[model samples]
Target: MSTTTEARSGFSPRVALQKVGTSLSNMVMPNIPALIAWGIITAFFIEDGFTPVPALGGFEDAAGNPHLGIVDPTIHYLLPLLIANTGGRMIYEARGAVVGVVATMGVIAGSDELVTMLNLTQPSDEQIGQIHMFIGAMIMAPLAAWLMKKLDQLWQERIPAGFEMLVNLFSAGIFSFLMALIGFYGLAPIVNGLMNLLGAGVEGLISLGLLPLVSLLIEPAKVFFLNNAINHGVLTPLGLTEASQNGKSVLFLLEANPGPGFGILLAYSFFGRGAARASAPGAALIQFVGGIHEIYFPYVLMKPALILAAVGGGMTGVFLNVLFDTGLRAPAAPGSIIAIFGNATTDSYLGIALAVIGATVVSFLIAALLLRIGKQEEGDIAAATAKMEEMKGKKSSVAGALTGAGAGAAGAASAADDSGHTGRIEKIVFACDAGMGSSAMGATVLRKKVRAAGFDDVEVTNKAISSLSDEWDVVVTQKELTDRARQRTGSAVQVSVDQFMNSPRYDEVVELVQQRNDPEAAEEGTGSEAAASTAAGAGVGVGTGAGAEPSADEGPGSATAPEILSPESIVLAGSATDSASGIDEAGALLVAAGAVDEGYVEAMHDREATVSTFMGNGLAIPHGTNEAKSSITRSAMSFVRYPEDIDWNGNPTRFVIGIAGVGDEHLELLQKVAMAFSDPAQVERLEQATTTDEIRAILGDEKESDA
Candidate 1:
């Protein structure tokens, strides 16, 4: 892995803030249903509701007696507690949740105390309203839980054996009580003041006609996977606070409005070129009707200038909402038209409707004009899907299906030719989140396969997804990050894999590269590279059973540094029952051979605890961590084969190769081993080998023959 690649420098302010926002949203997103239920109840039964119910709405009854209602208590206690409990659980699970609720009660109590104090000091008409502690809960819950976790860790094993239950119970009770007092006296007042200031700021923004400018910040963040963060983290609590006090809030529409995404997709449908134009209509329906605004993020990213359309559309909606004083009684999730209507204030219907319409029109017109001015053609739907995945950093089945991204490795073969080049894949880049660890390992494995396939002209390197460029002929990524890789380049064929150590996809990529090379071979007609036969259907998954015909490339002497592996070190059908015992057996072999100290075996276990050594295709390469490198006496490897699988960190493992590498010395034999096992056929031959001699033959170096 190249460290110079565009790896995120330490602590990016943007990424850090986004992560914090994401964490806040995580606490609320799972509880959206409860918020929706509250919204429905308020819309239907509150004092100004269509059918007011004093009993449920907490209003004066027909007899002029006030009744406590579900509305007041739900917002005052239930919602805050729910938020607290969710926040706590995120920090420390059930124990954290308990402490969080305990602390939140104090905040709620302090809020009531403040309300009572205001009533005593001020005239009834000027008295302060009940301050709900939603913000306080958001703060105190996670804080209380984190403190409890650290406290418990302090005495984790110091407690006497029989007093464990008593110590735990009393400690938690005392800690909760202390935290509750802190919440009531310290955090609650601070949060209350903060909320008041924020509420006033929003009112000021609205009055000054500058509230619409928020769309500039919001619209761009949505494309970067921060939609939930902005919606649930910043807006929801404030919107809920306003709704609790005034029965409706415009804040909900700021991010939830679907008009902007819908308009962008609609514009693409009419003015965009290639697959973006073809797929825009369906994406428009998903965005507008399905309330999945994320579908249109790719369209904006494909042509970054299109974000102006989103900003304009967002501003138009907010401007209309401000002008008409239109607002929803509850947050409109999915930003769907139906949801928006369902949650609108009774008198705000026309205004809300117009806001949506105006937003859509503005966005569409802006996007259409930009498309016309730029005239940039999106390569194809596959490229669009790749771009979508690249930005999202995850494989989206919906994106693939929506953009026809399912073309897989086979479709990548035409990528070179499609771009008006002779079909040749010269540069391959392996990408992961940080472009380290597993990605580098996967690249090494694939690079070995590519070289063995006789495509030595191909360049293989590992890169952080952030550094991916269009210069590469092919880009490979782990399954989780494949979607993110797609957005990096339009010309590269994209490949995804679950197992970096041995993926069938590696063979498929090698085959694609070889196919691209075949055209050049045919043009030459008499080159030895063309004359040399390749194993037929070598890329196909085949078992290399005993007596199976060898691939032309796997001839004897192809192995590099053959002395590193010997028949004496090979063990078949080992007696180990599980991964630990299996590690012990493999490590013992290396110990006896003087390859490593006994401490190295323990280090291997530690390394395994950090990350599983399991490399796909039934192989686990157990090695000591960097800290344990001093235990190595020489660069050597020992192989142990288990006929029956041992579970190696949830992956079924049949082979364990204990390695003690002195810098890059071990990479040579490691590469040869990768080449042998990369072919399922060769792996099958090793599995079926009855004698140690046969095992040695299969495991021997098979680097490309120099002669």
Candidate 2:
């Protein structure tokens, strides 16, 4: 024998029986409560208006009704079977047969409808036979299972690691479709064969005086996974005829698993305790009348071995039921209460009592014995803990940091320099209304920009516009926030941009900063001195230009009088500067031109709300997508924020704001802008510059002269 089979054989009969019993109990325990509730509902349906027939008279009713329709009883048995069977399939195989069951029912019902339609005129016998075959095919279909399995395998093989969740949903859809087909055409014949065999054996068992013993075993056994599969997977799709409505079928009692209920009652009856004693009566009330059985989860979990005992008792009960030729129209999940109203023979109550007694005795004895023997380890606690710890650590790593950021953007950058403030601006505060949306966006944009700009010691934060103070080094704000920022930072530079929020502008902003810091270097390549000399000659030609020119602050050659303005400091901030480009597309162009880091542009796309930075009128400023702190080396500035407002979140915006940072370098850019804006002429000159090249020329010339 194989190792597995040898292990199985090593168990003593009693132990082996106990193991089977536990598996059965585990399968049936959770379903008991829902079954009892459904059973009561079935009873009500029959009692209200449905008619009962004598052909289905075996099952007793609490109301003492002699007749009940097959439909009502069939429903009672069918629903519980469906739930138990489906639950079992889900537990064991992680796949449910419900779709197949439904499809089978639909095909049969549809075929019946077609026959009825034909009968309205007049139907032939052959036609009816054909319809029956069609129904049979529908009920026994197998194609569904094959299709579902194929699709599951395909998804498992092809789906990438990060996208597993999306694949699971796709697999579920395929599985559901296949199961529906199986229910219709793959299950009918098997049910019929079982019924035929049952019919042949019922009489012989009664004649042999084996009815009671069979009843004792059969009823409980049906509660296991195997019988549950047949009941739900087969009998339910057989069509709810009048016989089933009248509670005539033997299938009803097979629906519910009374093993757990019996075990609980016996336990309480024999070992009454403080809470256990009090709960016993309630348990009996629910089990007997309500038919709910989930009251046993705690019991089983506490003493798992008892589960096997319960299963053993259930199996015995089912066997006895079959032997007695007892049957129920409706299936009961927790069989205790609803079985009373199901279809049965004249001695139906005897069958119920026998099932209860047999199952209880077997469960109690086994449970008591197992309890005395002590518990076995079902799982390794230490291994489970270690596994959990490992998972937790993985979750805290870089991969975990990017879950919501989308596959394209996750873990794109480490948090090594993400503090927002590192090199320079330690007391920078960004302000906007509500301090939530716009300010947050502005802070993120600046942080990323500063980080990229190589300043790692800048601290940038956001606050409500009204909360600004003089403690801030550079107060950055939207036009709407300018007034409040001014009040908060007296004497400190209040940099107000026309855009709603600051966005990444690494290239242009960095270029502007470089020029401002070193005018000689900026003028090195560009003929700034020559441009100034030409402008001076033109002024001289205007007659008073020579006289109007301010006298050199120093005598002729004394260090050439600090020019007072830098050429490269000039910039406009709006979308009109690049009419042919989207903000991101333009930002990309700038990045490619040694303007900004590519990471900043990528971050803008990741946030989904990158366009929000262009608040209104002739303006489009894209910001960083990350909420985590970061920075850029410099901010990119454009000439005309924008002449006409671009459609930004449905509002018109004119400014095209771009910020690029190395790391915490935002404060320097802010200070530079503050100094530039301090002179109104420079701002006006930028607005009127017309072309991007002209703007660059004007700013370039101004910086050299100032130096």
Candidate 3:
């Protein structure tokens, strides 16, 4: 575990495998609808199907002339090409997909040629059949796409501007041609041999009665979001081949069996506690009836021990299938019972039904026992869901079902409803004249919030207004410069703010990014409660007027208090002529404490010049320019209360909290300060509190004096 942690911080072998499986699954998951269509067509039109159409099924027509049916061509060409294109896009987007398709065409042709050559050279009772090249497409597509990506990167910005189209077109074309040759001569034969090996291995597993053990792998992998990779990437192609020879193959039922998930959900409904118990019945409905196996993953994740149930159920299902000798005519996507029966062989209905029932019962019994043993340990459904998504690197579509109403508004209010931008916000930029002062500070603050919300992929950067590009998803700027920033880029959501530090709008921006990444989280009001609680512990929203007053037992002199905000740093009574003077006074306190240099005061004024430090709720946080970090440096904060409301820009400020943050060391403390003052009631209590100790208690944590 330590080695895994050192290998990749926050990622283990399980997560690494999940990522690989997800990537492979992504190539085929999108094309399941097409697979379903082909399956439906095959189930009805094949010669052995219920309503056999000779011409459509590729059988000899009434005139005895052979016809190429839709089924054979669809399987031989369409499906493989679709998989190749999808795989290519995964590597390098549309261009990669185009190259991938072109390369795969060569593999398909080479496979046919290989079969023709074999049939002629070794003509015997058993003629060599055409290899479908599904695996070949999966291999060649990504490889061709990756090569294209690397080739493009080499000439990326080096391409002479005006001739970019000409260079891109011809380069891709030439690269595609070369890749096709490689796929034909190099990849096709290798992939054919690999597929033959894999097929033989499966046959061997079946004959040896070891096939049921596959459930041991599939069940756990599914919980980690690798279900699609196993079911589609590995099983679907093999099943297609098997179905072509035999009327149906049991391979399709292996991973797509819904019994295990249903059983686990049923167990949760009976034995689980809290949100898991409440949401289980509904989740079971979605899992068993709706065919979304992902809905039950959180239940297993919330209690990893419950995986035994899934394994038990899955093994039971497989064993039953093997015992009954039942199979499906085509893949049953979503693993829904309806789809299962719909694709079942003419004689497989009873056996498949029994398999599902037996699997469910076994899983339920095992899961119920596990849940009963740990009945007191309530599952943190939201946390597990977040972990699952972290492992998946994206939100699951049906995972919301498990969270249900237990999901809270940990995230700030909905910003998409009012932010005026509906599109997804992936990249955010803070723009100012030089991008050195207020803009950089603002970006740092928002970036922290975004990270706290678990949006590691969303990029936040500070850029000079002149350097602003069209690719940004959200552009944050001071109201004074928003117009200038807008003129440079017309599409990005424009967020105007009055302050660089502790602005309410920052919360809105964080919420907006959160919504775009995880709509369910936003809808459920999910944010980082743990981070918030940590911040709260550091002191936030604990004021008397805020409805909570610390007892005499817990005051400023308490031993557990953070030392950053000590008695010397807090002034109960402070005075300033105006906002400018107040900011100077605040910076002077930091300078006096040796927390910053004299130059930091000037940067504070410069930052103020771009945007006011006056945040809402009668509070203002004056801070130096983002470029002035070198001026001096211990992380420190000072609290000054003005008895008279000082005129800050236009908003009356009763509290002026000065900050000199060193890197992100002061961010958690800053969050504490923001949360405390953001509330009007808390601000009111803060304004009325006469003692510095009283203010400390209200904010949350007490301050510890220097030893």
Q: After superposing candidate 3 on the true structure, give the runs of residues whose Cα lies further than 4 Å from its correct spot.
A: 2-11, 60-66, 121-123, 156-162, 372-380, 405-707
Instruction: Itemize residue pairs with steric clashes in candidate 3.
Output: none
lDDT of 1 by residue, 69-122 (tens): 899788889988999998998888788999999999999898788768878999
Q: Write down the lDDT of every candidate, Cα atoms only.
A: 0.73, 0.42, 0.74
Top-down TM-score ranking = 3, 1, 2
State which candidate, 1 or 2, has the greater lDDT: 1
Worst 10 residues of 3 by lDDT: 405-414
Q: Taking the tens digit of each residue's C-alpha lDDT, what string does model 2 give over 1-707? A: 43223222333333344334333443344554544443344444544324433344235567976454453334434443444343334332334344334444544444445555656676454342112222232223233433445666776768886887877765666555554444434444444444445545654654675543443443333322234334433333332231233434444554464654566555654553344444555555655566544333334434445557666666666666656655554345444555544533344668766766776677777765665466534332222222221211111111111112221111111121121111122445667653443454445444444433333455657776654544454566765556666654542335555553222222223222223223334447564433332332222221122112222121222121112111232234433323234456545544544445667666555432422455322334454543422433343443335555556556554444454433333333333332222234444554666544444333332232332
Tell me which of candidates 2 and 3 scores higher on lDDT. Answer: 3
